[model samples]
Target: MSKQISEITSHEIKVEGKSSVNQKSSVNNDLSVFADGWAIDTAVPLDLKKSADKDYHPVLKAFLAGSFSGTFSTILFQPLDLVKTRLQNPSHHVVAATVNRVQPGMITIFANIVRQEQIAGLWRGMVPSIARCVPGVGLYFSSLHWLKAKLGKTRNQDLGPLEAVMLGVVARTMSGVALIPITVIKTRYESGVYKYNSLGGALKAIYKAEGLRGLSCGLGPTLARDAPFSGLYLMFYTQAKQSVPKEWMQSPSAASVIHFSCGIMAGIAASLATNPADVLKTKMQLYPDKFPNAFSAALYVQQTYGFRGYFKGAVPRMLRRTLMAAMAWTVFEEITRSIGLK
Candidate 1:
């Protein structure tokens, strides 16, 4: 009887050991699957993991998409940009042919450029504009992507409106600082301040004339303008997208339309909020010697053009920014989606 009891106990111990080994093996297999980027989670489905999430070169893809979008939008809206720049330039006094002094409208400025500098002159700073925007937008998108990835903590990896604002502010601030030199060149090229025949010549001339400071003339105002603009735009855009019905987002065409509409609304709000900073940035970049800082530039605008001076190019700027941003984001989303990126 004692021997039978001993045999049963030994059998039980062997079974339990085998079960423990199987359990450890199962855990090891699960860990391996997770390391291979496939995880079994209760909240997020396995198939819902996008190709973009698995992509090794996400930042590079983002940059190319952003560059393509920026190029298309910048070229399409170059005329509006030129008009806005001309309107804001303190040097260009738009005196009417008649005896009365009046603030020139976009039509007046557009007509003047066509009449005096020819139709081609409407694209005055095309080279510099492309230079600044292509890479600038690329940098912005890539950095924005990186930030979202780093900061996102939700199961779906989504950002709230406030988080979106923070991401946009940080991303745009980095891009703005890195591209301010090109921005200054583009502004000068548009302002008709420098007479260089080529982009290279213009860059060389500016560097020689004012050194490094010349390249970064409007850094402060540029940051002030771009950071808040991007922050507010992203916040508004995110909220608008969330407000959209899930049914509407199912169709690609409907989604595109929704994105564009949301972008325009967001751009309008952000542009209005940041127009004063933009005006200051342009003024300081165009005449760095006269207005060395944002404060001085503010004073100059207030004294010269009064309360409305801060919004000198508001009309053309609003139009250009609204349309350009809408188009850029639309194109960017399409391209990224096509390339299997989210």
Candidate 2:
């Protein structure tokens, strides 16, 4: 009886050992399969990952994006720009019986230009304007990004609102310095005071007549106008954008609308604030002999035409600039988002 019982016990033990071995083998096999599948699923090509990662430098991307935005806006709004230039020309006005009759108002001036000079004449300075805007905007955006990066970075911090305004001023000032000549040429061409056969002719004529000074005619006034405009615009836009709800900012369409609305408001405020400087700049650039310096020009305009004169082209300037700002900023923001930049 004892021998039979011992045999049964050994047999049971052998059966249990076999079962444990089988279970272990099955678990090992399942784990191996799972690991293999995981390896296969996760094995994406390095080249593809690298290709996806590669992107333009932020500054260069900003430049290209801004160039496209500015050029498109300039082309579409050239007519408004032309009318603004003509309206801003101090020489065009005739003080007749207390009312400024020769220059008239924005609508009247636009109609007269279309009637007398033809519709195509509204785009007379388009070439110079485009030439100025493309590179000017490119430089402006690139420099802005560069400056922002430099200013924003600290031991462990980023940019604030004040830093943004400072960045805008520096960026605009640098670009303005480089683009003043082209701006002078565009203003003169649009003003109808100078008759040049070609852009080259205008350059030659200005260089011969007034030297390098003529090429940079209203640089001071331009800086005065642009610096404050840029600073205030950036500050206003930044604040306005921050005021939007996070959920509204999440949707692309909603975000675009917000950006555009902020841009228009910022542009209008800046345009109105800086209209006097813009008038002075235009007058000095168009008639350098008549208005030698920015100070003299400002005084002359104020004394001759009074408070209203400072805002001669306010309507067209406001409209054109607001549209330009909205389009440029919206396009630029979209481009940066697509390119995987913040």
Candidate 3:
């Protein structure tokens, strides 16, 4: 009787083990697609998987990639940035130069800069621009990746439009606050107002003259411009990508084109929506004493340049911002994809 009971128990155990194996096999067979860099690969060695997981640092990689992209785009678009600064400048010289022309367009101003100060003059604030952008964009991407990871949407996962907006806003706000001082310096450097011989000299001058408040001159309007622009841009870009057929994205070139096009569209929309804030931020930063706060700055612009003052640098800004963002995203995506990050 004891032998019969033992045999029955062993048979039942064997049957359960077999059922579990079959279930696992069925599930594995059904999982043909990978998501979030994870897949059930029974054939892969345990040690290899461990190594892969251990070495993968998505946030760090995102920072590096974003820095590279920002450097490239900033260098390319510095001239446009300089022009935008000049156009937004309500300084006597800039206004006087444009006051006589019937249409003082971007091209005309660009040519004048080249002819007057030489072509290199167009990139007047390149050093500070690169300094601000490289770290700024790196921080933005790293924080974005970190936030997404915390939210359990890391790598190869599709974010909803709202999620994208929230992520963009939060990430950009962090980066903006971290780099506001550099941003003020960069703006002054471009405006041709301050004779900041060196970056250090500029910092000392501003600190000695205006103290902490000077360093944080345009904090409010900068945040207002960046947060909403980033949010709207991400929302629009994500929606555009989602609208494309998945089949189309299978082609690498098609995917690149789709991404760049979406970035441009997103940039345009965001730039237009936030142009007023941008104008106000530039005014506040350039003439902190003249326009002490956002309200006063806004009133000054309205009183001085009329209704169109808010969109002063609209053309160059739209072009530079749109192209730069598109290029940056395209480069960032390529770099991340090559490195096996999503």
Candidate 4:
């Protein structure tokens, strides 16, 4: 009987051990499930994180983003650009003793184009405009970033407003060199001075008539306008962005609004400052024989139309440039953010 009791006791102890082992296993499984749930709730998904990692070189990414942004803005605002170009072109004359007896506004120009040249006239020189803008913006942005990085390393400090301005000037000057030919074509086409049917034809005609010099018609004025314009734009844009509320900066929509507003203000200031150079560029491109150079163009404009000649297209330029800058910078920033480059 005692032996039987011992066997039964031993069996009961074995059964208790097995039950305890099962309970521990269940507890461990529960803890693992809880931990996994916590991680799922708190951690970013691995796939999403990987996707956000930028695969392209930084300069290449900037170039692509800048190109896309510039193209998009140019397409949307080409009509405004055409109007501005016509207004700025010295070759287009507005008769002072016209039936209206008023200076022609953008509305009048638009009406004239539609009446005489059809609505499609509003998109004149769009191809050359796009051609100039894509590579120009791409080089401008990539060079800006590249210079900033190099300068930062050399200076061993964060880029300041002055550095930003210098970077802008250098970048724009470089891009402006490549922009001259396309700009000449675009300005001539928009001014209704050139009768070429296609972009290739325009290029061939310009080259055949005046060779390389004709293609680089407004280079001086272009550099003068673009360099300072870019510098002022970057300075003002950086200041404006810095002025935004910290809390608002955390919200993408709010940040975009700030960017757009700042861009408009910056663009207006820069466009006004650079309007005279822009006018000269247009005149030189449209009538290289007449204007000859930046000085000659400015003198001719001053003699013909007085100080107001320099500001003829100021309104349209402000509108187009403001909208384009707003869109381009906003889109570029968003792209950078999406690619985890910001």
TM-score of 2: 0.81
**Tens digit of lDDT per residue, candidate 4, span 100-149?**
65567788788777877898989988889889998888888888878877
lDDT of 1 by residue, 237-312 (tens): 8899889887997889998999999999999999999999999999899888999999999998899889898888
Superior candidate under lDDT, 1 versus 3: 3
User: Alpha carbon lDDT of residue 286, candidate 3?
Assistant: 91
* Residue 184 C-alpha lDDT in model 3: 96
RMSD, each candidate, Å?
Answer: 7.7, 8.3, 7.9, 8.3
Report the CA-based lDDT of candidate 2 relative to the real structure.
0.84
Candidate 3 global CA lDDT score? 0.88
TM for every model, in the order presented, reads 0.82, 0.81, 0.82, 0.81
- TM-score, prediction 1: 0.82
Q: What's the lDDT for residue 68 in model 2? A: 86
Weakest lDDT window of 10 consecutive positions for candidate 1: 90-99
In order, the Cα lDDT scores of the candidates are 0.87, 0.84, 0.88, 0.83
Candidate 2, residues 110-132, lDDT tens digits: the string is: 87778778989888899899989
What is the full ranking by TM-score, best candidate first? Answer: 3, 1, 4, 2
Looking at candidate 4, the ten consecutive residues that score lowest on lDDT are 90-99
Candidate 4 ranges beyond 4 A from true positions: 1-55, 90-97, 100-102, 153-158
Candidate 1, residue 22: Cα displacement in angstroms equals 27
**Alpha carbon lDDT of residue 116, candidate 1?**
83
